[model samples]
Target: MSVVTVRIPDTMDHALRAAAADAPSLNAYIVQAVRRQMTLDAARKLAAVDAQAALDLDGEGDAL
Candidate 1:
């Protein structure tokens, strides 16, 4: 694994600390958050592609 540095405002840092109180470590919390965001983004992209495919199919039917 690679290490990356992140900078955040003091207020956000405090919030993150509070949010991670129950977490094993700040890094673990951030990793979990990043993974969740990645999954959500992937799902959104897939939904957009499926929607476009449906629209393209509808257009093909109209052209026939």
Candidate 2:
């Protein structure tokens, strides 16, 4: 597996540390959290794009 380095602000670093304290491994916790957030963000963006496309189609049909 490839590895990447990330630099976090002091506040976020502290927060991540606190959140990962209960986790078995800090790396695993960060990976899981990032993956979950990415999934949610992608889903939200997709929904917005779909909604906009539907609106555009409606407008086009109205013009026809």
Candidate 3:
């Protein structure tokens, strides 16, 4: 495992601590949050690709 340090404003720190209270640890909470964001981003990209494929197929109805 690797360790990284980050700096945030006092207000953000306060909010993080407050939210982490329900989590097992602050580090774990941050990791989970990052993982969730990554998953959401991937889903959004996939949806865009799917939408484009649908548009491309729409004009193929007459060709097929």
Q: Which digits, one per residue and each the tens of the lDDT, describe model 1 over residues 2-63?
A: 88888878879989989999999998999999999999998787667765455445545553
Tell me each candidate's TM-score: 0.72, 0.60, 0.68
Worst 10 residues of 1 by lDDT: 55-64
Worst 10 residues of 2 by lDDT: 55-64
The TM-score that candidate 3 achieves is 0.68
Model 3 residue 15 lDDT score: 89
**Candidate 2, residues 1-64: lDDT per residue as tens digits?**
7798878888798888888998888888989898999999987876777554654455455542
Q: Going through the candidates in order, what is the number of backbone clashes in each?
A: 0, 0, 0
Candidate 1, position 7, lDDT: 82
Clashing pairs in 2: none
Off by over 4 Å in 2: 51-64
- For 1-64, candidate 3 gives per-residue lDDT tens digits of 6787867688799889999999999988998998899999987876777654564556465642
* The candidate that achieves the highest TM-score relative to the unseen native structure: 1
Where is model 3 more than 4 Å wrong at Cα?
50-64
Q: Provide the lDDT at 41 for model 2.
A: 93
Q: Candidate 2: lDDT over CA atoms?
A: 0.79
Best candidate, lDDT:
1
